[model samples]
Target: MDRSPPVIVFPPESGGGRRVTIRGEAVGTAHGLFDVLELLHSAGLPAVDTAVDDPELIEWRGGGPYDWNDGEADER
Candidate 1:
């Protein structure tokens, strides 16, 4: 199974929030990384940290936590 932050879909009207649809299943609604884990845990799945901290899954670690939004348009 692909463990690279399972591609999720945020459909409209999902209980008034962005329902996290992972692997075609609507686990729950989340808006951040921490919430992602909560959703997974609720589904009986391991948290993202478990995957990121696992040495064997280094390839999917995303190569360190670097600047995610450094370059961006100055919207004033």
Candidate 2:
């Protein structure tokens, strides 16, 4: 069974921002890794800097952490 993580990073929109959700609740939009980490930290996730890269912690839908553009196709 492929269960999704608590945090999900949606694909980047035309504005170059990716939507972030925690436990299915929309949190905010992030334009970069720092923004993502900030959101996660604000959401009360510990070790966010390292957690951002953990597949078990976050699900990067469209692209990896570095992708902040709309060029990538949706990977959901």
Candidate 3:
């Protein structure tokens, strides 16, 4: 059997608020470490606060957190 996780497409936030999107199999819903500020920026929302996560996942090519921006560092 092929058991794989769903690809969650995080849509850009709207209204300059923190929005979290999740997509996957039968898994528990838990909030991961995400930057509300970045989410707002990506969603073209107003940049007011500087949100950050402890050891965030980098969205690099080939899956997993590999890309680093600004002062964010890569875990893998």
The lDDT leader among the candidates is 2
What TM-scores do the predictions have? 0.40, 0.82, 0.23
The regions of model 1 sitting more than 4 angstroms off are: 1-18, 48-76
Q: Record all residue pairs in model 3 with backbone atoms less than 3 Å apart, i.e. clashing.
A: 58-65
Arrange candidates, best TM-score first. Answer: 2, 1, 3
Kindly provide the TM-score of model 2 when superposed on the true structure, using C-alpha atoms. Answer: 0.82
Candidate 3, residue 5: how far the Cα is off, in Å: 29
- Model 3 lDDT tens row, 7-76: 2223222322112432332222112234533443555544353223112221122222222332233443
Better of 2 and 3 by TM-score: 2
Candidate number with greatest TM-score: 2
Segments of candidate 3 deviating more than 4 angstroms: 1-34, 50-76
Q: What are the root-mean-square deviations of the candidates from the true structure over C-alphas?
A: 8.2, 4.6, 12.0
Residue 13 miss distance in model 2 (angstroms)? 0.3
Per-residue lDDT tens digits for candidate 1, residues 1-76, read: 7455453524323233345655566677543446656766776666676643443422212222221122222132
Cα lDDT of model 3 overall? 0.30
